[model samples]
Target: MATATIPGPRMPRAMQTLGWTSRPLPFVERAHAAFGDVFRIKIGRDTFVVLADPADVKQVFTGDPAVYHAGEANIILLPFLGHKSVLLLDDAAHLSQRKLLLPPFHGGKMRRHVGLMREIAEREIAGWPTGVPFAVQPRMQALTLEVIMRIVFGVDEGDPRLARLRTRLTHFLETTATPREMRRLLVNGPIRAERRRIFASLLDPVDAVIAEVIADHRRRDDLADRDDVLSMLLLARHDDGSPMDDAELRDELVTLLVAGHETTATALAWAVERLTRHRAALERLTEEARAGGEEYVDAVIRETLRLRPVLPFVGRRLTQPQTIGGIAMPAGTKVAPSIHLVHRRGDLYPEPMAFRPERWLGVRTNPYTFLPFGGGVRRCLGASFAETELRAVLGVLVSQVRLAPSQPANEHVGRRVITLVPDRGGEVVATRVAPDVAMPSAA
Candidate 1:
């Protein structure tokens, strides 16, 4: 006989609607506090189990891919990323697609491109004016976009259309992901109409650029020169020896562009904020970077991901009946493992909220506990690439520039789209740190 399902409190319908279409972190935090590790919340007639327990997160993430596929979790991204993108694949298809794209993000390949990342960062940082109050989010976004365009698409940094595409896409993402904006879109039909108009305005340039790349690849007689991710995908063959169609190629390109750039930008921006707030940590990072190479800087980056993960929660649907945390879960149920809550568990992390890079220096936490990039078969494809870019950009920034928060410490920053972003854009007063002088230790 099956175990009886554990009944949990449900979020009120109005609150559920508000939470679903608006920022839901406060409500989620309250539920976790009330119900312990696991709780249920109703969103638009569907019951989603929000789980923060590390054990339960491990079970759902590492047990069986079929039982908890990400396809159902990523429905919101489908209209933007499309079906063929690796973000939406599952089972065998997921595995195959991941294999095809794995080379560019592999350790060796990423190491080879570290110079490119550093070069881009140096170029961008050189342009910042002294003692200027600049929005770190937009500048970081632009820098990451340039890195992605060069490495992933092999597009020149001087391309005009690329700049326009980035602006349009950024605007679209900011508007669509805002809690208040999403609520309007969900409740008012006309909001979607306006969104469609904006989306159409943006897609034209993106399509033209991608189409040109596809045509160029098709016309090339010798494929040896094609070495970027785009080129690799162009040359890759399926089991039946069939090449990817233009439509498939377009989806993959867009996926890499959007997913590749946005999350890293968010992570970098948060790292800047954290480093600014903690003076000792920032100074230590700079000293370590100067003395050695990227090890300490890497730890700082990893710890940042642990604390304020770019994507706070990832969803998976239960395709088979399973029991987690002694509660029975049926098929078609959505289970969310929150990185925000999991990384802050006192048992797992002694000072869960403290910004300490030393924790990552010698100790290695379980993969499931430190899952900013997730784990198992469905782990993020660009994980290695992201780390490389982050290390390079952060190392450069911390060593060359000092960042001070423009806003007060008590200000409430919130989530936007697939990332944790500040509500007013993370404003920072940046000044170029002299190369010879040491930065004061973070207090």
Candidate 2:
């Protein structure tokens, strides 16, 4: 059995209460300072072991899959994502699902989508008049939704159902991230009358759409090799020659669509805000993008990912008793590698918060020290796809528009559901830098 060692000063009830309330960052920061790299905190019945140490993070994240499972950590998402969703699967199931989904996001496949990404980004930015204040999050979300719709469903933005689905899906994700609602649900069971009302409002429409898509696919008996993700999923068969059932297909599709677009959109919006706040970094990014090299643009994207990880924490449940940083944690305890905190560790990143793209130019940091898409078998399947789209989209944005934040810098960080979104919705004034460039393709 693992032994427990209390580290530093015990957390005051005030700080513990704050962890259960609205602001978690302050409690997290306080814990880091008082307890060094690792510590344990209790929020109601959940005891979360937070680790910001690089070695421990790597061990917990990339260690044996059977021992550290994400399915246990992400239980909250299961109701919406379904039991078979990749996020909730582990071991062989995760491996098998990952293999089936790999082809769509492979290097060759991702390169083909660059032109498509560039086109959507350019077209979206063109719609914003010079000096007009606009919300960047919604715009990015729309553009990403369009791209994902085309790739996943092989449908154009003009499809009436697409618009409705986007609206409903966005509302659902936003509702799940509400601090007050989330706290209530965490403390109480999800069966509460109010929680059910909100969840039903968002989920009903999505289920309808998923059912419609499945019905459409079933009607087509002449299904042959097709380019979209749906087609790939349809054609996939297990090693035993059993195909995925309709329920499984629906869960996987919804998971990919939501996970693929939402996080990338949030990351892109945050990247824009960061660039607007730091003029030096923005100028360097602009210059590098204009110069046109894979390495330079990649640097900017990497630095942005490092600074503001889309999914800030990768959670796992300890299957075996373990000690981290001299703190003993028992089996079934919740362990999270605080990616945001780890990325900001002064030891791993010099002047961590400063937006310096040059850090990634030639310098080598520990792989575990910078995990934007996570690590190990459960790593994000859409990571390659997201990177390709982000770099391509940002490349086009920088080349054509100069974006300035419309709100104060300090107020930029806001909470949208679980996502650390821009408080002002990333409101910005965008002016077209080059009118001569043909509007980017929307397909």
Candidate 1 clashing pairs, residues 3+ apart or interchain: 279-441, 279-442, 280-441, 280-442, 280-443
lDDT minimum window of 10 residues, candidate 2:
1-10
The lDDT values for all models are 0.75, 0.74
Model 1: residues >4 Å from true position, as ranges?
1-9, 17-23, 44-46, 157-199, 220-227, 408-411, 435-443
lDDT of 1 at 260: 75
The alpha-carbon deviation from the true structure for residue 344 of candidate 2, after best TM-score superposition, in angstroms, is 1.3
Across 214-238, the per-residue lDDT of candidate 1 in tens digits comes to: 7766777665574467777778887
Report the poorest 10 consecutive residues by lDDT, candidate 1.
1-10
TM-score list, all predictions: 0.88, 0.88
